[model samples]
Target: MTEIALRAEGLYKVFGRQPQEAVERLRAGASRDEVRPATAAVIDASFEVRSGEIFVVMGLSGSGKSTLIRMLNGLLDATAGEVELCGERLTGASAAQVRGLRRRRVSMVFQHFALLPHRTVLDNVAYALEVRGVAKDERLEAARRTVDLVGLSGWEDKLPGELSGGMRQRVGLARALTADTDVLLMDEAFSALDPLIRREMQEQLVELQSALGKTIVFITHDLNEAMFLGDRIAVMRDGRIVQIGTPEDILTDPANDYVAQFVQDVDRARVLTASSVMEPARATVSASSGPRAALKVMRDLQTSAVYVVGRDRVLTGVVRDQDAIRLLRAGTTGLASITHDDFASVSVDTPLSELFVPAVESPLPLAVTDDRNRLLGVVPRVTLLAALGNVSSHTGELPTVEPPPTVPITVMSEALDAADAESGRAVPSGAQEGAV
Candidate 1:
């Protein structure tokens, strides 16, 4: 079971004296207008961050996402509700207690690089350890190691102004890594960089997460950024969370129109995984099934190819219709002669965008498999294209692939549905073709 590193329940952050009264009135069904102008920065907010997972809290201006984050780290007192870190409750903790927790257990990265202009990069990074009164020699050693970790190896002596925007961000990241804190709080840390620089930072964060396994609470307004970095995202609206799900969940099954509109312009192809788009094979044959049985199953299913599975449902290979017939005439007893591994196979979490080139080139449908290489579903080229096209439509753009004569969008959904029993199908615009 995954362990939770941080938790917040029923949290509210109204910036006024009547917080309790406001909460009571709202709970009693009073219209928000009746609450007057209390600036309810956050209301009834709750979320959990799992150990080693990047959890994102995201929304546009005035959504209270930033306020919620402040509450989590105890930078701001919660108007109501509770927050626990690791396991220690913070709702009523003293100022010193919150400061100690922040200093020793969690680190925050600001949108601005926050590098000290007067201090060298090395001194700036070691400042955290210095604040704790570590010996200068010990602190500098630790700071050097962290600086190298963030890719600022030789710039230890340089001032913040000497570095590029991305480099300065790296310094901030290095500073956060000094004490090996288990949790990181990043509030729009990449929002201030250029687009290309921002992408680089995102990639670096992924690599660092893999290496460090820090529980990160990332804040952003960009859906694309949230989708790219977060293992799970909580979408906020009007100081309240409207949705909490993986990127694919938010895209395919939005919580409501508000969420749908917020992400309507997102690039679904980039965020969607193979597991989201793949459907089960409409027809499959066990390795023990003879040529005749395989042929009959193919004929019944109306597909030209049949997947061959072994014990435990491991996907051994695929058998085409021509091979099945040829083996039948030759009186082949088992599926040995016709089976081939020429088809493409992808893991469930493979991004749909990664499949674009392979999908177009492969003659056979793409197989979606689990960790044990067990067959789950397939992604045919047409089905893949159609899914991409549908996302395009959501962005108010034309789909790139004109539907071919043999395939229609409605038929695609039906085909996927027929195959989607164990591994649900992913269609362009929710089409249901049986498993690919």
Candidate 2:
């Protein structure tokens, strides 16, 4: 059975006296705008997060992203409704219970890094453990390991003032890691860093998430960041959740015009994964097959290349039609010796945008592999262009998750221009040692 990390049901938070009247009115078919001047910080916002998933909560300023995250950790009390943390009700828990849960179960990463200015990086990170009454020696050891984990191995002795904004943020993250909490609540954790550093932090966070598998509730205003990191995103507006879906789902099928406009300028390549552009491979050849037989198979399929697989369909290498024919005529026996690893491979989860350069650079199609390195599909260069081309222009149709067969040749030029423009802005994958 799937373990749910957290769940919020009919959650509502309102500030000011006589809150129940406003809550009742809002619940009885009243709009948030109508209940204005009442300070409805959150209204009937409910969602569930699966264990080990990065759940992102995003909205415009005043959309209640921060409020929602605060409520999740019990840092802010909900006026009404229940919050279940790891199947236990956190809503009605006493202040002491909430404090205990926070100290042991939840760790938060704030936007403006709250590193202790007086302490060194190592000491700042260890402070969280120290608060829990952990021994000084043990906390420092744990803090040192976390500092290394966050790529801050050499600067453990430096104070917060001695480090740049990015380095300080890493220290903050290292502090959270030291706690070893099951749930992480991050509120605009990287919003302050410069573009390059922010991107690096984003990548590192994804790396750590992959390694640690901590259930995370990340709050952000950046849609691109949310799309890149979120396993599922909940978009809020007017103190209410408007939509909840995977990035793919939100991108391809926005809930309304508000969302559609929000993502209009987004660079899709970065957000769309390899699975989005990947198509069925043309053909496959057994490692035992002779070069002549492989050439014949390519001819039958009317293709230029085929992926070669060893026993159990484990991918070996790619065999081009020309290579197959040349090897056969040169007296080569089978595919084992003739196949080449010229093509780069990515996992099904790799974003389509990262492949833009590799697609243009490599002659062979990109192979998509599974956990065991079994061939799942191939993302041909043309398929990638087709996917990008279909969205580059405001072509009449709504964008669908499915990739198109072929796009106009102009796709290459337009895609490049868009890619460049998207890089400077904060518009916001995968595996098998894939080359980008």
On TM-score, the candidate that comes out on top is 1
Prediction RMSDs, each to the true structure: 8.2, 12.3
Residue-level lDDT for 406 in candidate 1: 26
N/CA/C clash count, model 2: 4
Model 1, runs deviating above 4 Å:
389-436
162-270, model 1: which lDDT tens digit per residue?
9999999999999998966778999999999999999999999999998989899999999899999989999998778888998888888899999989888888789
Give the TM-score of each candidate: 0.87, 0.78
| Model 2 weakest lDDT span, ten residues long | 427-436
Runs of candidate 2 exceeding 4 Å displacement: 153-158, 282-302, 305-312, 316-344, 354-366, 390-436
**Model 2: residue 47 alpha-carbon error in angstroms:** 1.7
Q: Measured by TM-score, how close is model 1 to the native structure?
A: 0.87
